[model samples]
Target: MTTSLVDAESVLAIEIGSIHTRALLFDVVDGQYRFIGAGRAPTTIHAPFFDISEGIHLAISHLQEITSRILLEESRLILPGKADGSGVDQVVLTYTAGQPLRVVVMGLLEDVSVESARRLAASAHTIITEAIGLNDRRPPEAQIDALLRARPDLIILSGGTDQGASRSIAKNVDLLTFALQIIPREKRPEVIYAGNHALVTPVKDVLSTYTQVHVAPNLRPEIDVENLSPAQDILADAEFHIRSRQIGGLQSYRSILAVEPLSAPFAFARMIRFLSRINNPGKGVIGVDLGAGNLIIASAFQGNSAVSVLPMGTGPGMAQALRTIPISEISRWLPIHIPESVVEDYLWHKTLHPTLLPVTTETAAVEQAAIRQVLWNGLNQHRTRYPNTPLLAEPILAAGMPLTQWSPQTSLMLLVDGLQPFGITTFVQDAHGLTAALGIISTNNAILPVQVIESNAFVNLGTVIVPLSNARYGTSILKVKVEYEAGNQISLEVRQGSVTALPIQTGQTARVHLQPLRPITIDPIGKDTTRSFKVIGGVCGVIVDARGRPLSLPTDAARRRDMLKKWAAGFGA
Candidate 1:
C-alpha cells in the first residue's frame, strides 16, 4: 500500500515565496492533468532562525485540510476515488528568494566594461555591491572598505574581451587580492571572472589563491554584442548554492532543484518564446508580473528582448505612502472618510506584519491604499528606467494576486492610472491570479500555460494610435481615429499616460492611424526616426515618429496628482 501510494497519480506543486506560500494540487482527469485545489499561507521570513519549513508545513497542513473538505463536499459526483479521497499523489516544492543575493562587479573600466557588467547584474536580479575598475579615482583602500561594508555573497570579476586588453584587468585582480587579505576565508565571497580568457589562469593565480574562483566566457567577447549566458548561469548557480547553505528550513531541500535568480522573469520569457516561435516567428509581445516583493517587466520586440525586476512592492510603498504622500490622496479613491493616522498606522503595521489579516474597517481601507501604492510605484519605476519607452503604444499585460481581489473598476482604475504614468494605454491581466502558477505549468507541461494565458489570463485594455511625437506630458499633438465598419469614426487627442475610450465594442475591429504632427517614426529601440509607418495594433501599436524626448512628467506629489486627475477625466476615468 505504501509503495502504491508513492506511485499515486495526484500531485501537488508548492511555491514558497517571500510574501505567500501556495500549494497547487494537480490530478489526472480525462488523460490530462487538471487543477484540483490551491491553498495559501502568508510567509514568515523574519521569524527566528528563518525556519522556512515552519511556513511550508503550515501551508501544506492548510492544503490538506482544504483538499479533504473539497473531496468530502464535492467529489462524490465529480471525481474518482470518492470513497477514500486518496487523490493527492506527490509534492514538488519551489521557492522565491527572500534575501536578495548581492554581486560585486570588478571590471577593467568604470564606464564601458562596468556598465555592461551592471546590465547583466540587473537582469539577473543581483544587487550590485561594488563596481571597481583600473581608472577609478578611488584608492584601493576605499574600494576594499566599500566591499567590506556591502558583505556581498558573490563577486563578478569581468573586463576586456577574449584577446583584448589585459592591463586594466590585471589591475582589478590586484585590487581584489588586496581586499582578500582583510576579509576572513570563510566569509570571503566567491569570485566569477568573465573577461579575457587568456588572463583567466593568471587571475586564478592571483585571486583564486585566496578565495574560491570560477571562470566564465567573456561577457563582451566582441565590441558590438555581449554574450552573458554562461556568466549568468554561473551567477545563478552560485547564488542558489550559497543561499541554500545559510537559509534554514525548506530552502535547503528546494535548492536541489534547478532555480535561477530571475526564475519568474525567465519563466515568463520562455512562455512568450514558446508561443510566438511555435506559430509565428515574427512575433512581438510584452509581459509584466507584480508581486509583493518585486515587479517583473519583460518585453520582446522583433524576436529579441530584455526583462527587469523592480524592488519596490505594494507592502513597502503603502507603508511609506502615509509619511510621504497624503492620506487624503488615498481616501479620494475610497467611498467613506477615514482618519489619516489610522490609515497610516494600518499600512505601517501591514508592512511590518504582512501575514496578519485586516480585522477592522480601517485596516481594510489601508489595504486598498497599500495595494494602490504598490501598483503605482511599479509603474513609476518602469517609466523612470525606460524613459524613452512609451507605454500606450504597447499592450502591457500585468499579472498579480491583488488584481484578483480588486473590483473591476478599482482594478481598471489602477491599471489605467499606472499606465497613464508611462503612457501605457492597453492592459491585460490574469484575473484568476494564475500567471505565476502558470509559469511553473509552462515549465512542466508545454503549450498549456500559453493557451490559458491567451484565453483567460490576459485582457486587452484598448487600441489607440499613439503618435510617437505626441508621447510627451502636456503635449496633445496628434489626432487618433478608429474607423469602424459603418462609416463611424471616433477621434481623440494623444495624451501621455491616458487611455482614450472609443465606443468600439468588444469583438469588433477598427483601423487605427497616427496623423503625426511632425514627420516621425520610432525605431525598435523607441528612438524617433525621420520616417513613418502605417498604424498597427497588436501587443504594441505602431511606433509613430516623435520629435521631443520621451515623456518627462512631473514626480512632484501635488503636481502629479493634479496631472493624474486631469488625465483620468480625459478618459472619464
Candidate 2:
C-alpha cells in the first residue's frame, strides 16, 4: 500500500521568485511536521544564467551544507527518503518569476458574467487587457482590432445563463472567431468557454479550428448562484502550462516535482483560506505580500477567498506606485525632513537595484513610507472587490521587506499606520517567507498545514485593540484594566490620537476589561458597551491604538515630521 502524503516524513519545498530562489526542508520530528532548515540564493532567471534550475540547485546546495544531508543526486532532487534519512520523501515547487497572464474577458453582461470572469482573472494573477461586453459602444471592427492589439495569452468567453439568450452569445462567438482568424495560427490565444453549456459544442466547433478551446462549467449556471471554482481551476491550469513554456527549463522543473507547481498568488489564496477556516470562525483573515516586483493581497471569509495582484511593488512597480500616491503623502510617514527630490531619486535607484538593503535610517524611512502607500493602494483595490466585507476587524498576516527586515516595533507600527484596524484584531508576520510554500504543501496533505502552523511557522506580532471614535486629540479614549496571573491587575489609560504599547510577552494571556468613555465605542462586539475579553500577546505584546477612524496626518511639513517622530517613539520603532 502506498504511504499517505501525511505519513511521508520529509519534504523539500522550493519557491522560485522574481528576485530570489528559496529552498526549505521540513521533516516529521517527534511525530510532527517541523521546519528544519532553509537557504536562499539570487534568482538566475535573467542574463548569464537563463535557466531557473541553476538558482534552485545553488539554493538546494546551500541547504544541504547547512543540514548535512544530500538533497540532490546527479543534479536532481532525491525523492522517497532513504532508510538513513538522507533524502526527502516529497518535493513541492512554486514560482512568481514570469510575466503575468494576459487575459481578455468577453461577456454579455458586465455585472453577472463579466464580473465573475474578472474575479477569476484576479485570483490567477492575470492582467485583463480587454473586456468586451454586449453593451459596449465600440463597433465590431474596433473591438476586434483592440483584441488583436492587446495580444492576450488567453480569452475567457462567459455569458448567458444555463438556458438564457443564444443570439447575443452567437454574435459574440462569431466576433471572437473572426478575431482569431486574423491573428496568426501559431500566435493565436487559447479560448476557455465558460458560458452557457448549451453553446459549448458550437463554441468549441467555431474556435477549435484556429485555437485550442477548453470547456469549463458555466460561471453563472442559474443566474442567482455562481460556481466559479471549475473555471478558476481551468484558468490556473492553463496559466501554469503557458508560464512553464515561457520560462526556460521550467517544464523540466515540473517533471521533477511530486505534483504540478502552483502560482504564488493562487497558493497564497489557498493558505489564507485554510488559515481562516481552521483558526478563526466568523471573522475573516487578510494576508498581504509586498514584494519587490508585485504586491499581492488575499483575504478569506467563510471558507471563500479572493486575491488581488498589483504589478506595483518596491522595484519595477515602484514607478507605477509613485504615479498612484503623491510624494507628499509618502513624506508624511517619514520621521525626519527629507526633500521630495531626494526621496524620488532614492526610489528610482531602488527600481534599478531592487535587492539592495537600506543601511541608513533615512533610506529605511523612505522604504517604509513607500510600503505604507503600497499597502494603502492594495487595500483600496481589495475593498473594491469585496465592498461589504470588513477588513479592519480581520486578523492580518503581512510579509516582504517592510515586515521581515524591520524591528518588531517598527513593523507593527507600519502595519498599524497602513492598515488602521478597528476593534480587536490580531497581527502576524511571515518572517521566514514560508506561507506560500506551506500553502502548496497543504494541498497534498491537509494535516501538514495544521502541524506546521502549530509549530510556530509564523511570528505573532500580538493583538491590537482599536476603538472606533472621533474625539479631541488630548481627551481620554478608553481605560483598560488587565488581570493576569494570580489576580495581578494593571490599569492603563489610552488617549485619542495616541498609540500605547503594553508589554505582555509571548505565551501569556491576559483578561482585559475595557471601559470606553462617552461617545467612544468598542465595535468588536457592540457599540458603546463595556466589554471584557481575553487577548493573547506575542513579540510586541498588546497594542492599544486610540487613533480615530480615517487616521490623518498634519498638513504642515514641519509638524507632520515632528508628529511622525513622536508616533515612532511611542511604538519604540
Candidate 3:
C-alpha cells in the first residue's frame, strides 16, 4: 500500500455516505503528502433529490470556498491542477451507498474452500445469507431450497485448488446451475466463480446460461495459502453497480468523478490491512465506524482481517438493530432504570428523526445506552467472522458522528464498555471520518493515507492498560507511577473493577513505571527487570482499566448504574 506519487500534486477525494458527503483535498506539503482542506454537505441521494451529484457539488463548492481554489466548473472538475492552484490534479470516489449485498457461498469444504469464499463475500458491506459446502449434510433438494430461500443478490462458488481434483467443484457448479434455472432469467442472481483455476471455464459456461457470471482468481490456490484480493476487486465492482442503480443509475454521477467510485465499506475493511501491517509487534488493530445507517467493524493482525458491515446504526437504523441486539442488552448499559417500552419507543422515534438530539438528560443517557449496545453487537458479529486477530488491539479506533458528540473521555468510556478490549491497548478517534477516503484512494496514491495517519489527522485518546488478574473487586492489583513531560509525577494504585485516567494531557510525553502486585501479563524483554516505558499522552492521558476480563458488569441494574457513574467520574467525564 506504499507507493510515491509522481505526477499528482493535489488530489481531491469525495466520500459519500447515507447521511453526508465529504470532499477532502490532499497535497504535498514540505515534500510529503498532507491533508490540506475538507468540505462536507448533507447527502441528497433520495426523496427530493435523487442525483448523488448534488451533494458532491455542494461539498466541492464548499471546498473551493475554504481554500479559495476552484475545483469545479459547471458540473465537472478541473483536472491537472494549474500553476495558480485553482483546481486539483486528480479526483477519486468512495461511498457507502446502501445495504450490504446478500450473498450465498458454496465450496467443497465448510472450513476450507467454503470459508475462503465466505471471506471474499464478508466485506464490511456484504452479508452471507447462506453457505453450503460438501460438509453440509442437507440433501441436494434441501440445498436448492435453502439457496432459493436466501434470495441472494449474488452467488459465489469456490472449491478445490490449482490443478486439484474437480469432481466436488463440478458438483457444486452443477447444483448452482440447476438452482439458477429454477428462477427466471430476469430474477437470476449474478454468480462469481473463484475456485480452482482449472474449473473456471466449466463453471462460467454453465452459470452464464442464466445470468452474468464473473470469473475471479482462485481464492484458494493452495491448501495452506489464502489470497482474496483479486476476488475482492470483483466484489467491489459488483457492489458498486448493485448500489449505483438503486440511486439514480451509475452514469448519472460518473461525470463528476475522475474514476469509478469505490465501495466505502470494502475500502474501509481493506484499510485495516494497511493499519495492521504497520502496527508494532504483538498487537493488532481494531476499528469500528458507527454511522447513521451502517456500522463497520474491522480488526486486522499481520494483514489478515475480519470485517463486517451491519445495515443498522444509531440513527436511521436504530430500530433495525433490535433484530440482532436484544432489548435487554441495551437497557443494561443505561445509568438510570428505564422501562424496556421506553427504550423501544426511543428507537422508533430515533428511526423517524435520525438526527434528533436528546430532549432531556435521561434521553441523552438512553441514547448512549443504545449506541453502546450497537457497537457491542457489531463487535460480536466481527468476532464470528475472524477470531485470530489479537486479545488486545493497539490504537483501537472509534469513528462516526455518534462518537463525535461526546468528549474524548466519554468516548473512551464507551469504548471500554462496548469493546471490552483485553491486555494492553491504545485508542484513537477518526474524528473527521476521512478513513474511507484515505483507505480507498491509497490504491491510486498510497503516500496520502500513511502521511495523513502520521499527521494529527486522527485524535489520539490515550493508551489503556488492562491487566489480567483474578483478584476480587476493590483489591489493589497494579501500581503505576506517571512522570509527565512537565516534570510532574503522580502515583496511582489501581483496584479491581476500577477505570481511571492518570495525570497527563495531549501532546505530552511520559515515562511510566509499572509494578504488578497480582499475576499479570506484561510482555517482558531486554536486560532491565523493571517494567518501565515511555508513553505519549492523549486528551484523557493514560487510562487504567482493572475491570475483569469478559467484563463482569453488576448483575443488578441499580448497582450497574452506580458502577457506570464511578467509571465515568474517574475520567472526569
Top candidate (lDDT): 2
> How accurate locally is residue 539 in candidate 2, as Cα lDDT from 0 to 100?
85
lDDT of 2 at 400: 78
For residues 1-573, write the lDDT of model 1, one tens digit per residue. 223212235545667677777766665444444565677776666666376666655666676687773432232212233436553433455456565667788787676567667766765445687777777788778887888888887888888977999988877787788778888888888888888888988888888788878788888887655775566556656655666655576555554333232345555544444433443233344566666556666655544555566664555434434555566555544333566667666666666765566667556545655555555655565445434333333445667665545544345556544443232234555554455555555555554454444453355444433344444544666666667666777776654444455445545656654565543343334443413222223332222222233333454656654654554444443
Alpha-carbon error at 28 in model 3, in Å?
3.4
**Candidate 2: tens digits of C-alpha lDDT, residues 1-573:** 224445856888899888889999998867778888898888888889888889988999999999999887888777777887777888898889977789999998899899888877877767899999888899999999999998999999999998887898898899999999899987888888899999888889988998888889999998877777678678777877777767777888776677789888888878888888876575788898888878888888878777888877888778778887888778778888889999999998888888878899889989999888778877888789766455544579898764688998889888888877777888889888888888898877777778887888888888888776677887887788888866788998888888788757786888888887746766755443537888788788888888776778888878888878877877778
TM-score of each: 0.71, 0.95, 0.90
> Per-residue lDDT tens digits of candidate 3, residues 1-573?
225454446789888787788899988776678888889888887878887778888999888889887787776777777777768887888888655678999898788889888777877467789999988899999999999999888888888889995998888877887888898876778888888898777777877878888888988899977877778888878777667656664456566566677887777877877898998756788888888888888888888776777777887778669887788888888888789999888887888888888879778888888888888777877787666656668878888888767888888888877898875678889888878788777886777788889998888988887766788899988899988777879888989889878777787889988888887655322222436878788888888887876777789888998998898888667
Scored by TM-score, the top model is 2
Please state every model's RMSD to the true fold in angstroms.
Answer: 7.4, 2.3, 3.4
Q: Sort by TM-score, best first: what order?
A: 2, 3, 1
Spell out the clash pairs found in candidate 3.
124-309
- Residue pairs with colliding backbones in model 1 are 10-89, 391-424, 392-423, 392-424, 392-425, 420-497, 469-546, 520-545, 521-545
For model 2, what is the C-alpha lDDT against the true structure? 0.83
